[model samples]
Target: MGKLYVVGIGPGGLEHMTAKAKEAIEKSEVIVGYTKYIDFIEPLIKDKEIVSTGMKGEVERCEKALEIAKEKVVSIVSTGDAGIYGMAGLILEMKKDEEVEIIPGITASSSAASVLGSPLMHDNCNISLSDLMTPYELIKKRVELASEGDFVISLYNPRSHGRPHYLRECIDIIKKYRKGNTPVGVVKNALRDGQEISLFTLENFDDSIVDMFSIVIVGNSGSYIKDGKFVTPRGYSL
Candidate 1:
């Protein structure tokens, strides 16, 4: 039986991709991933067999990858880090004692943080606002708790056309624990083409600027904005 590799391609850029991730894809006979993610590495895996699916076909995609792995080496790719909001978890949960390797890459939170200065230099947590697999109520509770704990927060899947007001609702919960001037950074398409980085305050943030492609970083109470950058200090003496 051939081995299966779950790899993180990282921000859709070859520069951001780890060497191991590239090696995994290069060695695999087949490449499987979301359609957009597959397009990101299209040049690299041009000669390999590609099995891609659309938005909600995650389960079907993984199942196909696992089945293909039984006879040939397969690399299942995920954008950003596969472990974080990617396919690593699902692949592991579904595989049964199969020889599987997980290759980690830069996560979106860190990619966005690099563009927005050091907003994640201190303690931080990532929360997804998408309610397809998880309940919105639970997500709200998590946002509130993270806010109360003063953890620098990275929000994934902030908003979509179907759930337009979810981000606004999360911002309201965050406002209850964080100050109006707390630094908020929005990075769209981080490390990828047409990247846009914007800094805002918790109170003045424009939800309209956010979308499924953006990663929102909400600074903790100690976070600040300076010289057009958002920063969450690590509390070291000057």
Candidate 2:
């Protein structure tokens, strides 16, 4: 039996890539991941066996990595924190009798929040709008509840080409609980090349500006913008 390391690369930046994550891949005999994630760490994985799969091939990739790890150490890479929408869960679920290690990296919400402002200072929840595995109704309910609870929301997989309306629908539901002027921050390609960040309001944010790669941080009722920064104060004055 061999060891399997589930690593998160953290938004494609070498600096954002944790040292442990890099070391896991460096020490591994095989690296398995989606093509994009594999390429993100291509520089550190020279001469290593890379088994990259295409989109929606996570299960195949993880299984293949585990099979290879049967004799040699393997590293399976995910984009953000391995536990948060990464390969950690799948790998653990599929771990029949192998030593599975999860090396977490900073998740998108945390990194994006840093880039945008202090929108996640208080109670917050990170929700993905992908709807690939999660039902849309359930996602909507989560959004509504998060909104009603006055928790800041970090939305992942907000707007894809096929699911363009998901982000808009989610924002609409959130607006029912939040004021129309509620602060919203959009961070695209966070911390990666071609990064973009912008601030908008609940009623004015155009869905066209976002894509699958974007993370939208919608502020709670008490959230506000200070000096062009989106901020959700943590009772500092109370």
Candidate 3:
């Protein structure tokens, strides 16, 4: 029996790929992933058999990968951290009797935080607003709780053409706990092609430029900006 490897290849480019991730893909007899992510590492796995699925075909992709793993070494490719909005959990759930290995990668929040300053220096939680799997009310409740907890928040799938007012809706929920002037940072396509970062306050945040590929970071009460970088201090006495 061959092995199953769930690999997170990081953002869209090969530049941020880890050695382990590369090895998993390279060692695979078959590579399976969403079509766009498959395209990113297409060159590296050109010799291997490729299986591509559409955006809404996550379960199908994982099942196909698992079936392939029964007879051949298979790698299930994902963008960002496989555990974070990736294929790892779905694969695990379907692996009722099969063994699988999960290889982590750089999640979008951390990558965007690196581009912005140290906004995640303290406690934080990442919330995705896509509402594809999660309920909108539940996401709103999480956002409110994170704000009440004073957690530096990283929001994935913030805004999109499909959900034009989701960002505004989130901001409305956040303001109930955080100050209007709280620092906020937005990074689009982090560590990938055409990356853009926007630093602003919660009140003046511009959601117009955000899309499905963007990541948004909102600081806690103590967070601030310095030297043109977003900084969320850790409350050190020194």
Candidate 4:
């Protein structure tokens, strides 16, 4: 029976690749991933069979990877952590065989938060603004609940060409339950080249400056900016 390893390659740097992930990639006979992600790990995979897909088509991509996995040891690569808004979910949904191994990597939100201190030190929830599969109404509802419950939110797929105003709409929903002075942080391409971190308040967030490469984190009412870092007290110190 062939085995499949779903590896998270980290954001976009070779140094970020975990030892386990690199070992898996090196041992695998076949590698599958989006073209960009494939490029990120190309240096590590010199002679491995590679199959890459364009953006979108995640379900189809997983299906094809699984089909190949049934024949040989295959690795499906995802940027950042595999479990968080990565290929793991799609792979699990299409997986009939339970013999797959999941290798984790640093998620962009956590990495971004690290660069800005610990924004998720307290309770937090992650929401993707993309409505490719889910309904926009549901996304709005989740954002509203996250705000009302005072949970710090890490937003993924905050903006794209198809949904230009998605992040703006999310900010509006959040403001309905939180104050205008609520702290928000934007991290673009975290841990990768061209990385940018910006600190701002909910009232002053500029949607035009954000894109799909960025992760937007909105702090709760109790969250604050200290020493140029966004943080939420976990009550452990209290």
Tell me the alpha-carbon RMSD of every candidate: 0.7, 1.0, 1.0, 1.5
103-219, model 2: which lDDT tens digit per residue?
Answer: 999999998899878999999999999889999999999999998898999999999888889999999999999998899999999999989998999989888999988899999
Once fitted onto the true fold, the runs of candidate 3 whose alpha carbons sit more than 4 angstroms away are: none
Per-residue CA lDDT of model 3 for 1-238, tens digit only, reads: 8889999999878989899999988889999998999898887998999999998999999989998898899999999999999999999889966668999999999999999989999999999999999999999999989989999999999987788998899988888888888999999989988999999898898889888889999999999999999999888898
Q: What is the Cα-based TM-score of model 1?
A: 0.98
In the range 1-238, model 4's lDDT, one tens digit per residue, is: 7788999989879998899999889889999999999998888887999898998868878998899888799999999988988899889888997468999998888888988788998889999999987899999999988889989999999998999988898899888988888889999999888999999999888888899999999998888898988888888755
Most TM-score-accurate candidate: 1
> What TM-score would each prediction reach against the true structure?
0.98, 0.97, 0.97, 0.95
Query: Which residue pairs of candidate 1 clash?
Result: none
Clashing pairs in 4: none
Which prediction has more favorable lDDT, 1 or 3?
A: 1
Q: Which whole-number lDDT from 0 to 100 does residue 91 have in model 2?
A: 89
Please, what is the whole-model Cα lDDT of each candidate in the order they appear?
Answer: 0.94, 0.91, 0.91, 0.89
Best by lDDT: 1
Residue 81, candidate 3: Cα error in Å is 0.6
lDDT of model 4 at residue 68?
88
